[model samples]
Every structure is written in structure tokens, then in C-alpha cells.
Target: MVQPLDSRQRNRYSRQLMIDSIADSDQRSLLSSRVLVAGAGGLGSSVIQYLAAAGVGTVGIVDDGRVKRSNLQRQVVHTVDDIGEPKVESAARFIDALNPDVTVETHATRITPDTVASLLRRYDVVVDGLDNFATRFLVNDAARLAAVPFVHGAVYELEGQLTVFRPGGPCYRCLLPAAPDEETVPSDEPMGIFPSVPGTIGTLQATEVLKCLLDLGEPLDDELLRYDAADATVVRTPLEPNPDCPLCGSDEIDDMDDIDYDDRYRIED
Candidate 1:
């Protein structure tokens, strides 16, 4: 059932309502959507804020980490007061204050193999803001199995990338069959990302999430977009499911059971 926007809602969302593509109905659709954000770090900061600002009805935040003083640099949702608090809690507080009408579900737990399936099944879509390749790959498989569309964003130093994976499209595995060796990939190269890198990429991820929810605009499905902060350039790459892809290929493996997420492989974002 579509809930009509009240006068206060209309006034509060005037700017967004003015957009040609976003009608009151689209706002209502956004209000009814369920989106799960997989992390509460740099990328997650912008994603969570924008989604709440847009009135996504239910936003599930999954993260086990606590806010640290260092996190304040990019994790904008948290503050000095939030340090030592669970990231999920701090994020929930941020959402509640930003949009009280929006319900926030806080899962202060890590996304592990045992928890991934159950966690993902609860939301219509997911936004990836994970730091490690291990958890990122895990979410990809779970999303593929659940048939839910997920927006993936990653930042490295001054660059970032964004993509979307759904049931019928090429998955992350199709883009990279295996994680790169940690030694060759260098785990610490992008030690501390430029704050704006994740911020920009996360904002784009939120845009894609809105597109997926509203069925408006072209989504990043089947394509990879890399954003270079140095020159402010975006490179788009077409993607296709490899026949030998482990997840969504014709001869795909049974499941993600045999895979080792800790086998660090880093793909340049």
C-alpha cells in the first residue's frame, strides 16, 4: 500500500521531489524499500547517510567493529563521543536523528560464512562497503544465491570502483575468478584511503541502490566503473559472465563452501 506523503514530508523533501525522475510515488517506493548496508566504514558513511536522507524505510546495518578515534577521519556517521561504541549502534543513532520515520535495524555482528546467508535473506538489496576482499567475496556469493541485487564499492588510495551484481548478470567472480595472492597484491599499499575516494564511490553506490529500488535510470549492472581521484576520471568496463565462473557460470561450482575468503586477493579498484 502506498502511503501518501504528508505536507511536512512534502516540504522536507522538496528538493528531491523537484527532480524530474523522482516523483512522490518514487519517494514512497524509497520509503518502502529494504536495504542492507554491509559495513559501517568510510564507504558506508556516505551510503548510510544518503539512504536515510532519501527515506529508505528500513536500513539494516551489519558491522561488528566499534568506532575508534581514527575512524572519525572517514566514518562521518560517528563522532568522538561515538568512539568505543559499536559501529552499528552509532550508525543507527545517526539514521534515527536524520530520519526518525526510517527504521534502523542494527546487527552488531560480523558477516561470516555461517551468518551470511541468513543475514542477506532479510533484506531486498545490499550495499557493499567492506574493507577486505574476503568478506566482499562472501557477500557476492550470498547475494548471487539469494538473487538479490547488491551495489559494490571499494576505495584504494586515491581511486575507487563501483558495480552492481544481480542474479541474471555477471557476478564478482566473473570479473575476477580468484582473489589475487596477498603477497603480489600487497595488503597495505592503500593503507589509508583518501577520505573523498570512498565518499565519492559510496555516494555512487547509493545512487545505484536508489535506481535498483525505483526501477529508474540505468543501473551499473554488468559493468565496472572505476573513478580516479587524481584526474577525476571515470572508466567504464563492460562485463560478461565467464562460462567457467565459479558462481554464475554454466559449470559453476556447487557453492562457496570450498572457498577461502582469507586467501587475500586484492583487485585494484
Candidate 2:
């Protein structure tokens, strides 16, 4: 069982609790929540930091990439000295220093079909910070298998998108029936993400995660929040579950053997 925050923690979280929408009970729920954040890159940086600072009980970061000097532009969690270090390790170190109350777990490897279900089973919520559609699809399927709510976010150039996938809401597969071909997508290194693109989307993702954990306010499930940072406008679109989606439709996934990640977009897949 999770322990209640002491006076210091309570005081520290008072501002958040004071919000009419989030009271003491909500704060307590956040204090006991466990969230799994996939990818520690641009979006992951903001998501992990915000969730940790908000006093989430446990935050698991899964990423196998190393911090590069170029990542410093938007991957705020790592510093120049952190370059060459594994992203999950570097992110865990930062979260530890930021809030000792939040337990940080590191999975220093890419999330794959074989490993996703087991990794997700231990957490109450999953944050999708990945940049590719294939992994996004896998994440949606894995979360369905684990039966956990997931917050999803993505950024490209000046545009960003956010949504929540609750048990009955539209899944990622419903958003895109099939994964985009690898040759059609470009990596962040070549595509060039505006520093604020992921920041905006990731912060929104963190907000949804907190709302879901606290059961406060309406979560973003079934709603697509799109931000055109370049134009400074935010738009909302309602998403409905695709009855024909093979992964999370009316037909349930029967066996783990049905999972595969070979079609996932990657720099060198």
C-alpha cells in the first residue's frame, strides 16, 4: 500500500490541491499513482518531469537511445554532460534529484511487442511519447492488453497532437487504421522539430495523466487536441472507436503471438 504524504509533502502539494477541481482526495490519488512513460526524448522529457514534480508515486521510463548534443535543444532533462549516457538512465537521475518522493524505474531498451505487455502490466497509466506510428500502434495494443488508460502525444515540425485512450474510448489503431510506411516518415534529426512543439504536446499529455489519476475534470479520452504552434491555435476533434480496427475493435486480441513490431518506423529498422 502507498503511504500518505507527510506534512511537508501535503504543504508542497497544497497549491494543486487548492484548485476547486482537485482537492485533498485527488492529491492523495496522485500520490499513490504509478505511471509508465515510454520514450525519454523531446516529449518524454517534459512528460516525465511534470509527472514527477506533480508527486506521482512511481514513474517508469523506457528508452534505449543515448543523449546526443543535438537533443539538448528540446530534451530538457539531460544536460551537456549527460550526452552519451542512456536516456532512461539520465532521465531517472534527473527525476531522482527533482523529487525523491517519486520512485523512478528505468528500462534501458526499446519497447517491443514481446516486452510491452509485461512492462505495462505494472503501471496504472501509460504515456505514449514515441515519435513513430508503428510503436504508437504497438503501444495502443499493449495498453489494451494491460487494460490501462494511456495518454498519447506526437509532434512534427510545428504541429502537435494529444489524446487519451481509455478502456472504451478510441484506440490509436482507430485513429490510424494502419501504420505509415517507414519510407514515408522522417526522423526528428532530419525533420527538425521546433523546440516548443513537443513541449506543448508533452505538457498536455502530463495534464491528462494527472486528471485521469485524480479522477478530476473530464479527461481527453475520445478527443484529439491539436496544436498548431506556428499559428498559435489549438483545436479539438472528437475521436470515435473504429469498429473495424483489428487490434482494439469489437474483436479482442486472442494471443500474444499476434503481436509484431517489424513494421515499426525506426532510423535503422
Candidate 3:
């Protein structure tokens, strides 16, 4: 039930439509696609920008936080005037201004095990832009249970990582297996992040989303793409689904109740 591109769409996506892999049909797929962005911070900002500009028909933004004066350094979608506004609302405005064709659904709320599954079912793909490991693991587990694709991205200082997990593929749990010891996890100190790090990873996450929707290029299926911004080097490492992975392995997860994420991550004040 794909719609034909109108005059406005043709003009708006002229450059993209010219790509041999992304013609009218692919563009139509993008128009029919629905993507959920997990956060509205640095990575979410970039993911939303490109996804909207590329004419994604529906985008759902989920974040319970509000903008702060400190977030302006890397969260590109929010402005100084939006510092006091909700991140979801600020991000929605940015998307609307970027492309009116895009429909943005904002969930100005926190993501939890109970709500994560419901949130993910509403979208075709999930973009991981969350800053914390707790929410990230929640998303990872939820997407796997829903049998949906999750584009994973993370940034720490000058380093970033990108990966994709879909049904029957290696998942986030396969990589981490278990959360780091809460006691040993570093507190959110003033660890300087090169602004471009998240930008780089977020853009790659967007690229993965587009490719997933269009089925064009090879996805990072079982491989993690790591980027070191300081050295300007990219490395690809192959990953295999852990046979013992409780989430996506021989001991497949049946529901969210059995898992305990409470002690896994501690929120810093």
C-alpha cells in the first residue's frame, strides 16, 4: 500500500531518488516506514535530523528528560531558547521544521521494562541513542523480544560504537552478556567528549536504519563498528550470537519479568 511520490516529494528528495539503490520504490518505502528514536540527546538529535530529512513518514521520540544548559554542546536539535523545554518537544519542533511530511509522536516519559515493549511495537525499527547503560539494555532486551531491529550506538569520550540487532541475529546481550558491576561503573564525571563522536555514531545509526528499511546495503548484522574519533580510525569486529546468551540464545528469554535491571545500573544525581 505504498503511495506514489507527489510533485513536492519528488522535488524534496530529488538528490536521494537519484541513487540507483534508492529510487521511487525505495523512497516510497521510506515514506511508509516508522522509526522510534529512544532518546533526544546528542545521538538522538542527529538520528532524528537525518531520518526526518530523508522523508521517514512517522518518527516516535521517547525521552522523559528536559533540556539543560549543559546539553547544548552536543545535542544539536535543541537551542538556547529550548533549554527549559522538554527534550521530546524540542526535538519534535526540529523535525517538524526540517520536514513537514514527517509525523512525530512524542512520549515525554521514561522507558521502563513494562513500557519499552509497547513503545517498540509501534515502530518498524528502534534507534538506540540513550546515554545510560540501563535504558540501553532495556531497549536491547525489548527489541529482541519484539523481533524488531535495533540500531545500537554509544559514545564515551572520543570513542563510539555502532551495531544492529535483528531477529535471529546477534543481539546486544550477546555482546555484553551482563551489565558491568554497578559498583565499578564509572560515575558520570566531567569526562570530556569530543562533540563529533556522538555525531559520527548517530549518523551511522541513521544510515543503518535507512538500510534496514530499504534492505539495500549490508547491515552490521553480527559485527560491531567501532570508531575512534581521536585517531580517525574505524574498526569492524565480527560477533556471534552467544549460545549462552539468556536474551537471544539457546536459553531464549520468554518475558521481561525474569530479568532484573534494577541492580544493574545506578543513576547519578
Q: What clash pairs does model 1 have?
A: 180-265
Residues 208-251 of candidate 2 have per-residue lDDT tens digits of: 99888888789998889999988899999999989887767755
User: Across residues 1-269, which tens digit of lDDT does each residue of candidate 3 receive?
Assistant: 65699999999999998888788988988988999999999899999999999999999999999999999999999999998899999999999999999999999988987788888886899999998777888899888877889999999899999999999989887888666765666545445778878898999999999999999889889899999988899999998988877777755357666665555532211
Give the best candidate by TM-score.
3
CA lDDT, candidate 3, residue 212: 95
- Model 2 earns a TM-score of 0.93
**TM-scores of the candidates in the order shown:** 0.91, 0.93, 0.94
Per-residue accuracy of model 1 over 109-162 as CA lDDT, tens digit each: 988877888888768899998987768888888888788998999888899999
lDDT of each: 0.86, 0.84, 0.88
- Model 3 ranges with Cα > 4 A deviation: 187-190, 258-261, 265-269
Q: What's the C-alpha lDDT at position 43 in model 2?
A: 97
Model 1, global lDDT: 0.86
Worst 10 residues of 1 by lDDT: 260-269
